[model samples]
Target chain A: MKLALVLPLLVPLLTAVACILAGASRVAQRALSVLGSGALLAAGLWLLRSVDAGGIQVVQLGNWPAPFGITLVADLFSAIMVAITGFVALCVAVFALANIDPARERFGFHPLYQLLLLGVCGAFLTGDLFNLFVWFEVMLMSSFVLLALGGERPQIEAAVKYLTLNFIASGLFLTALGILYGQFGTLNMADLAVKLRDQPSGVTLSSAMLLFVSFGIKAGVFPLFFWLPASYHTPPVAVSAIFAGLLTKVGVYALIRVFTLIFTADPATTHTLIVVVSVLTMITGVLGAAAQYEIRRVLSFHIISQIGYMTLGLGLFTTAAIAASIFYIVHHIVVKTNLFLIGGAIGHVRGTGELKQLGGLYRDYPWIGLLFLIPAMSLGGIPPLSGFFAKFALVKSALEIPSYWPVVAALAVGLLTLFSMTKIWAEAFWKAEPEGATGGTRGPVPLLMLVPIVAMALLTVAIGFFPGTLLDLATRAAGQLMNPNGYIEAVLGRTP
Target chain B: MPLQLAFSIVLLVRGHNEPGGGFIGGLVAACGIALHGIAFGIPAARRLLRVPPPMLIGTGLLIAALSGLPGLFQGQPFLTGLWGGSVPTLLAGQLKFGTPLLFDVGVYLVVAGIAVHLIFTMAEDQ
Candidate 1:
């Protein structure tokens, strides 16, 4: 059990080292990358199974006791997250075999990629707030290099914006950490939950707001999400897919963790604020997507809109709502990642992602078109697909609370989301090739790129077909979030 | 230059019980290397460090990560320190060895390599 908890962090660190040592041989590094991701997935699944069967798993590092030593805990929510991260990392690693150019590969892409996974797994598994900050920095450093690896003009421009904004977000997070430590004298999340409940609401609210904004920026929420769309499309498609699938979701996970576990004191105020931000986030994100002509830019905007849906469950602050949020997160991660990979496939085939420049995908490569349609329709919340269930659960929970405005906004945003999806389908797939266009293949589409896209699309279909098992797991995770005593107990070991 | 390097090693070793640690010690060593470069030339400094900066960084990270495996083997959590009996040294009294010390040594190499790499890059650009 203890070994399982550390595997997610240790495996990636070791893989990165091996990649670095074998840096001269591109083939060796590539093999090691795939092997590492495979190990990560196995470890994640093992940890998830253990946590599911035996309850929350905790390991205190270096023999230090709780609240002092670095604590690594895997609740069902975190285990699911870590497992999904491993899954996505594997897919992206495979896709990069074709998507990344030789020059970038030689620029240490494999080692940096492994480091990024290490940081992400560390973020998900860590139990301390300050430790979370450290992991965030690790993730930030690797991703910054990944974004700028090619050093193209557009990439450099996007990297600057990304770097500046994320640093500010980190600054806000650090300030919040300082305030919390001053107030409670502890940075262990479980310890804070116990100490915070007795404190005056006013003091906690300030730190909560700071943390919300910090995580809010990372999650791409309203009034602070400008960085996402401006920069996401500039990187290589494989990088974009992993970033889309995992990066923002970590912020959402932190929001869910802190809001549920640590800041349950004044939900009436904090959650209400979240509801307002969520609705605004949804409306604005969908509107932005509707206006975009580029495939990736459209998908990036949708990331923000979908984040609103995930946080809405938190704002609703009910057991069912949180479960729906978890369900939504799982479904969105798979669907959105598939969409980006399909976009990459489209780019590979057509030599461009501009909808106007793209055409005849449905006519020439119907297999690719079919792959694209699954995730596209799923993202639009078409019935019987994964999105439908996720949206249905969230809407049901919201209406149960009788929160009518958010419901009205949510349904409207759903329609807008469909409009954008159809727009991409029509412009990129259904239309004929424009005059003076090459009208045929850019080059042979690499099977490596197509494999992960198909796999993720199949995952979308599977989740849509078998929502019951995942929903049950999500409900159990929500139960843990609603009552964090189990988490607190596991970390602090039966605190009086 | 040799005295400076020796002093930095002292800082790194005593860091477990004193104010000095890997980061400061590495910075001090990097400074010594920089001073030598300023006086004796960049090639001389580079020759003084036998390996490339990146190799140092990678090796340091490898050592740090491997240092944790002993505890895993001992059925403790990852990074749990396992101390060995003290070994008598000629200069210092009995010096104890443990995973923490190994971890610090790894950090020292990494920090020093990074500092030197930055300095070399900046100086070479001129």
Candidate 2:
């Protein structure tokens, strides 16, 4: 009933068009970018507050009723996600001012960036399976252009890789949707949830598997995640930061959203499969990180590893477990994006991301080094930081189920994560610079760039300091998740 | 009638419920405009349009977005279809006065703008 549901998508859509309309004036584009993002942040906060207080909100497009019309639904998980999306978009928009080359700007980086946000917000807010597919395409289209925008040889090569794998994933998702629609005659997610309950056909199971593989590829799980590391490190850091922060999580959010709300008929077999995937994803991701010599590449691999923890939260499938996953997602988005931004700053100053060739950063730039250490340690689950609480919540949930294997995998990943962080610390910040090192002589790092890094770092520290509110929110989100009845009631106006 | 203009008019009029819409119709127009650009060159096309492509894109998008606002005023969802009570004019016949039709017009302008801009800019590049 709430009209606020539409704002999340509408605001971003308007912002994107505004950015495009600004055209050729980099200053105007930047101004529009900031203003649009600021508006989006407000919309996101407003959405979260209303959803948190008023409960799940569904906006029927053009006044059509549910199970028929395209709907934008805002549950707690979606609201939190939309809120964080605005924050990341705001930070990255500012950072791009300094980070993206002027050449890219002239090629319409600002508009494309806003379009990307539009697509992302649409994906988060959509309540129809088919609508989700459309949004995914929107996101993928913009991402493809953004990745290849600069036309660098590496950018092109990596863009092809990024584009190919994601296209396949989209095809798989679309195929899954086609089958589900054929069987149920509905694309509305809540309607599907009602119809598919207690009906576990072989066709349904196979379709579920298809969805798993599809979202897994996007989420960057084991064996399906090869494209992520190959391409993520190749983009400009701001682009990579947003990509790292939000893109894969959309896949993860989809996984959690669909499996919990629709595919609950065969949790025994499907959940088991996810658990095994989580273990391998963790082990392989950390191992991959260990082998990487570049800072971005190492961080890229860690993204896979950290994803395993979130999947572990999903695999456990308890209220607390899902809550932990939600918490983990927020913490990772902030910490990981900040890591990439800091990496960008280092590359800016030192002229390279090659770890061995980089050193003595702590000596010359202790402030930057300290900024790096906070997120890095938090990532490794250092005590009194964000990651530790996120890890603790997941492990505690695992123990409640007495599921030892995922707990073991989660613990080992934490240790290896620490090892990888220490490696980056030793090579990039602690050890002395290799003789005759040179970096970009763009003078000192500009305030525009530093501001985002510091803001994100402070946010991470604040999350560490005040875990109670977020934990409560995650708990409430998970509660609504475990029982989809409220969501169904909200959308359908009665129990199915 | 010119082949380009005839084809574009057909495509634009037949778009909404048919297979073709703003995208294809605009592409149709773009083909005609592109031929014009190639034949007469970029300067001639700019002179003919009387405005730049970027401006076209902006105005088109503004129209598209503004077309949705009235729905919000009526307490309905944004961009919901809204038809008019007015009798149709000769030109506006078959095309209802509604947000949906306006949206399509907006899309047509946008598609036309983007296609022409890319084509012209690339032409200038060479």
Candidate 3:
């Protein structure tokens, strides 16, 4: 059972090595990447079931036991995140197969892709704070290469800004880790939670704030999110899809883990900070999304806005709120990734992602049109879809907090989200196709790419219909997080 | 030219536990590559390296990220290190083996790869 936690991280690392040794053999690299991701997907699902049937499971590595060595933990939250990451990664891999040119595959795409997954899986499962930082670096490094993979003018420019800003963020992260370690003398998250229990309020508040700010940059929270829109659209579609689906959510996941477990005592400062940021993030992100004329750029900006929804749940700081946030994260990842892939397919067919150049795609590519519509509507929080359920749960939780402003802000964001989705639909799919367009004659997206999109879309709808299962898992996960004692006891023997 | 020398200094400073490590090392190495491209020509370097810079960067990141896994399940943080067993081996007498060493190797590869890539790109422009 513990091996389940270890395998997801191990499979990708081994596969990456194999790919490297294979020396750019396209077939071998692709096979290894796909096989590795498939294995991870299987492992993720198994872990998800185990968590659901049982509860949080902890694996201590190298026989070192907890608090002294490294620990991999899979609660409902981490398990669900791992599952979503695997599903999206598998999709991205298939999409890359179609998207990456044969010549480039030999370079480093397959191996890097596997390594990126390893980082993400590690981030999701690790029970320690410093380990999270390492995972972030791992993810960031791969992302830099992927961003610059094509090495076009825009890519280089974008990569420079992206790399520079994230470098600073990474530095800040390290500093924060040093501070946390200095303050508590421990980097293990579970142990820190226990040790921090009796700490001075000032120290606790400051440390929490420092950690929040660092993660906010990565999560693209308001004021720190300028880099996201500037760089996200520069990448190839597959890279953007994976980044959109997984990276920011890791930050959000970390925020939820820390705030709920470690810093639960001070709701006034932390929760208020979260609430303020949530509103601003929503408003600014929607405004950015609304202003964009490019498909991918709009989607990228929306990533910021949608993150507001998750933060809203965190701010509310209740079981339902956190569960809804988890649910929202799951829905958003799938829908957002699908939307980006659809944009990619549109670009592949239209020769550009620009709205002005793209038109009447719905008629030319009916399958893609359907695929895009599902996620689009889902993202808009239309009823009878996963997005609606996520929003509903969040809204209900917000209202329960009796916070009128947050409820109003969430409702408004939903409307704006719909508006942005419609804007894309209007310009890219509904408008008249330009005459003599280069991609007008291009065929429909290949089955491999479309299958994953459709599968995600189906999952979105299915979860919407039956929210009980996921809601249960998320609530259980939230409960575990809220009661840090269980986690502390699991990681450190009996709280002291 | 002076920038490369400065970068080397910074990398040295970063070696202990600060920010400088492999990533900075790679960037510095790239500066050196760029200098070579300026001195020589783009195609000449490409032929010499036999691969692109982005690939190198990718490979480096992969190696670096993989080095952290041993700690992840060991109940430590992802990149946490553990050292054990002084080797009583014939040649070396005693040696330390741990995750951080693996991470350092990852840093080395990533630095080398990115350095090569920066050089390649600069050379291409020249």
Best by TM-score: 1
Runs of candidate 2 exceeding 4 Å displacement = A1-3, B1-21, B89-95, B121-126
- Which residue runs does candidate 3 get wrong by more than 4 Å? A198-200, B1-91, B94-126
Chain B in candidate 2 has what TM-score? Answer: 0.84
As a TM-score, model 1 comes out at 0.97
Q: Which whole-number lDDT from 0 to 100 does residue A29 have in model 2?
A: 83
What are the per-residue Cα lDDT tens digits for candidate 3 across A240-289?
A: 88999998999899889889878877788789999899989999999999
Estimate, for each residue in A1-496, the C-alpha lDDT of model 1 and write its tens digit.
Answer: 7899999998999899888878678999899999999999999999999999999999999989989999999999999999999899999999999889899989899999999998889999999999999999999999999999999999999999999999999999999999999988999999999998746477799999999999999999998999999899999999999999999999999999999999988888999999999999999999999889999999999999999999999999999899999999989999999899989888887888999998877888888888888988888889788998999999999999888898899889999999999999899889997877774366666899888988898888998999898999999999999989999999999853
Q: How much native contact recovery, as a fraction, does model 2 achieve?
A: 0.67
True contacts kept of each: 0.69, 0.67, 0.00
Order the candidate numbers by TM-score, best to worst.
1, 2, 3
Find the candidate with the highest DockQ and give its number: 1
- Local accuracy of candidate 3 as per-residue lDDT tens digits, B57-90: 5566566666666666565545556665544434
Candidate 3, Cα interface RMSD: 5.4
The predicted structure with the larger DockQ, 2 or 3, is 2
Off by over 4 Å in 1: A198-200, A439-441, B39-44, B90-93
Q: Of 2 and 3, which scores higher on TM-score?
A: 2
